[model samples]
Target: MLDHCNGHPLAIIALGGVLATKKSLDEWESVCKNIQSHLQGDEESYSGVYDVLAMSYYDLHYNLRPCFLHMGHFPEDSRIDVEKLYNLWIADGIVSSTQDQIGKERSLEDIADDYMNQLVQKGMIQVNRKVSDGRISSCSLHDLMRDYCLEMTREENFLQIMYIDEQQNASADALTDKARRVTMYVGKEDGQSVLKSLSGKFSSLRSLMFISTSTEQDEDEDSCEWIRTLCRRFKLLRVLDFEGRVVLKGTFPSEVGNLIYLRYLCLKGTRITELPSSIRKLKSLLLLDLRVSRVIIKLPNVLSEISLCWLYFPVRILSQEYDNTQGYEIEDGSQLILNKLSHLERVSEVDLDKVDVKSLLERTSMRNLSATCRQKKESLVPFLKSSTIKHLSLKIDAGLLTGNSEMLLSKSSSLRILHIDAGSWPVTQLTIRVDMFPCNLVELGFWYCKLSEDPMPVLEKLPNLRNLQLHICYGGVEMNCSDTSFPELTYLELDGLFFLNFRNVKMGGFPKLLEMAIYNCPLQKIPDALHPGINILCSSILDPLANEYRLRGKASEEVQIPNLNTASEEDQMPKLCEFPLLVLAIIPFVMLSFYFCRSKKH
Candidate 1:
């Protein structure tokens, strides 16, 4: 079957994907026979490869076909955020609702994740990046695959892409009005004009995306007009994405409330400082992303009227400054009161100092929380006692995790991933004990805690930890790991530990480790032995053992250790010398001699 592919990479990949699900030899034989039949007349042409790619698409189930086509809506070569894609799929009904055998309903996000995994297994989609816990964060399609998807979308009248520029020759007649989704790539300076041109054209549009292609600054006066136009015209919009594309001046346009049918609204990376009261009118909104936006002082209680499943805000937006003179009152205080939104499941970067953690948990159905404790004396015990929260990120003073409060984390049986950052505060000594961590944690990280002792002895006992990161969290000179420790650990990262020792790492330690990274750390050797396929990354400088391993030629396939001497070696090579002065002096004489020779010839 591969021989018929003419050694084409895409064909081989597509063919492998097509055959991956076939269980019986008869089915594989039938597929190969069909491919041969397609290539009978034109074996040298790429039509056979196209057939293989098409077969992979056609193999998708009815529910997954639309989800696959939706990938075409993103800009070419851009990494599509998987979380955003899931929301879009849910909003568009591409990820259909399902129920288990016991008649319990399943969430749309779960179904979208399943569909994405199926496509990934079939090689129709490529994973671009993953989070530390082994879940995909972003993904992309190959250029050839993206082209195929675009062609299918055009044929199905699913979506249209417009590159908004002066030279664009697309006429109203040429642009299909049936395409329910439209993506516009335009310069920041031409944002308003482009929006004006696209108005009322695709009245049936269900999704609209504005992607900025230029770095030019935007004129805010004209910016809100386009948004108002969008709300008034595209009344049926389900997904409105302006991520990093526009700055909504000082406030969100009240006109957006007109899109009552909107489900996913992304304002990420924008400069909007405030949300209008009218946003409460979006009763159908499911996801609102304000990550990396300018500070928003207050969140209106009216937002509880909407059914939001995922809400992300900038870290400092919800944090407030206490006015000691005013007693318990804060200056421009922001209260996170989303208790009425029963469907809300995830919220990030909430200020625990102002918001009661226990009250927030009991009032809402949120299971994923990211909060910050800015007050130096704030208790972290409330956060550690919760057994419902699955993913937690806490940025607090280092001293807050001491004694009984630190031991409370082990009570969080439901926690899967945890990150603690105490970089802002000064602490003389901090100790980490094995009993202080939840046994079920799959990923854990510590930053700037300046621990007085080595944590490896405690961390290795975690039965389920797969990813571990220590960024200047230890102050000791030496550390040791017992043999056969870290049975489930796969990735380990050490950063900013300039004088730490690695000589004590046992050969059998980190038995299941697949990758290790050393950054800004001067180490002479790694563990004596490791798995054959393990990957080692040394960012700053490679020590003697690493250099020797690299020289052995076995490191070429699995290791990413940078060769620091390459630049210096190239610099040391001999160079050509120039006699510019002598050449300049002879130039005039040579010119005069040439003139005399010409006269003699005349």
Candidate 2:
């Protein structure tokens, strides 16, 4: 018997076998002896013996067989909280009678402890001790053991379906008998009636997921009504996910508020913009994912006051009522409302593209700001000057940075990180006077700017420069002049510049350079003299490397050539055989040439 059931023979016999003889001392003794004999036959018999003894003792003490059946509820590979387990046991009334002879001497907790210890010794349960709480907090089951438990403990008449893809009538016919859990993905045509049928059949369902796979264009009112009814009926749903476009055209049903027990609500890529106001009623909601949902109109004003540990929403100004200001508010003071969220230390990103930063700067206090400007450069002057900002990102039209370079650099002095996204042919040169720029700057990024001159002059002035990025800066810019070196630079990135070259720039000499990334530059032959410690990353090395080379032509004339005879060895030699010998050789050579010419003429 022990060999047939590993160590869980008691649960198996109690759940599967008929009553053995009668419920008496003699019958229990006989059963225990038989189990013990079976265990004694194997060398791996210790665990089997313990299981038999614990089960027999439990049966003798607690008459109901269902008391031991509840252990199968713990999921495999997951820990069971001791307090929760104990509470569930008490609620199920699994305790032995106090009037019984064997039960009178022990408390139910003690009996449960003994059973747990026996299970541990029999290799059925693994106990985990949490050090922080100083308690035995959890119990886990092995896969094999859990499967055995499920097999022995599950009701014989229970139904299990893996995947269901049928019409509503077919599904309804199949679900006529009570099923434990049903999982089905619905097509657009059948999405409505299928959900209605499922809601009626499976009220006690543990999980329901309606995955829409259709690419249908039109969503009718019946579909929305079907979803509304499903949300109402599945009040006890633990996990609800609308994977595809399951839009709620009208407001969500107020009855959806009853899903208070929902743990995960994922509405990824849905067109539904606004959540029902009743969404605030879900106090137990742990994860609410509304990514890529275009229909969200506005987040509730009370959201800032709630103690939500996780939230994702479009960046907006906080309400003004939370601010300490009263009747003295300005007429266009909507920008001032962002100040109310100053206490939100957990907010990591803020986009102030459309808001009036002049008003917001007076009240708002943010540590990280990502702003996109639809207005002119002067309108963003106040936000650039913010002292609380640590990271600043700007995506503005090219004209904003033209004459405002001084103003931009002035406000940048307090910034540690800066990202500027400018348009093509930016009104201003991508050059800066480094002397007045921020000394604390660590990272600088330039995007889509026409940079014809070297950017090193400003870069070298930054004492704390660590990262530099240039994207789409065209017009054949070569990095020359090693005078302005980044001593603390770690990362250098260049991307999407067709004519940018990194050769002969002597970038290898950067003392602290760690990583370099070059992509889509279409260049061959990187500078052979790169820093040995620096790591180079590029797409390919080819003739495209010529794109980074800068061209220059000569603007002046050449010097006159000198006569070779004037600087001969004879002139320099110190009177070798006297000057008369040199004159005699010259006279003879001249006379012989004259005599040969006279003979030719005669």
Local accuracy by lDDT, each model:
0.68, 0.48
Span of ten consecutive residues with least summed lDDT in model 2 = 550-559
Model 2: pairs clashing at backbone N, Cα or C within 3 Å: 273-295, 273-296, 501-548, 508-530, 508-531, 522-544, 523-544, 523-545, 524-542, 524-545
Residue 41 of model 2: what lDDT? 23
| lDDT (Cα, 0-100) at 352 in candidate 2 | 51
Top of the candidates by TM-score: 1
Candidate 2 clash figure, as a count: 10
Name the lDDT value of residue 330 in candidate 2: 22
Q: Write out the backbone clash pairs for model 1.
A: none
> Model 1 over residues 155-196: C-alpha lDDT tens digits?
788888887665543333248877788877766543466666
Model 2, span 262-336: residue lDDT tens: 655655545444456576677655445444233433333333332222233332222222212111122233432
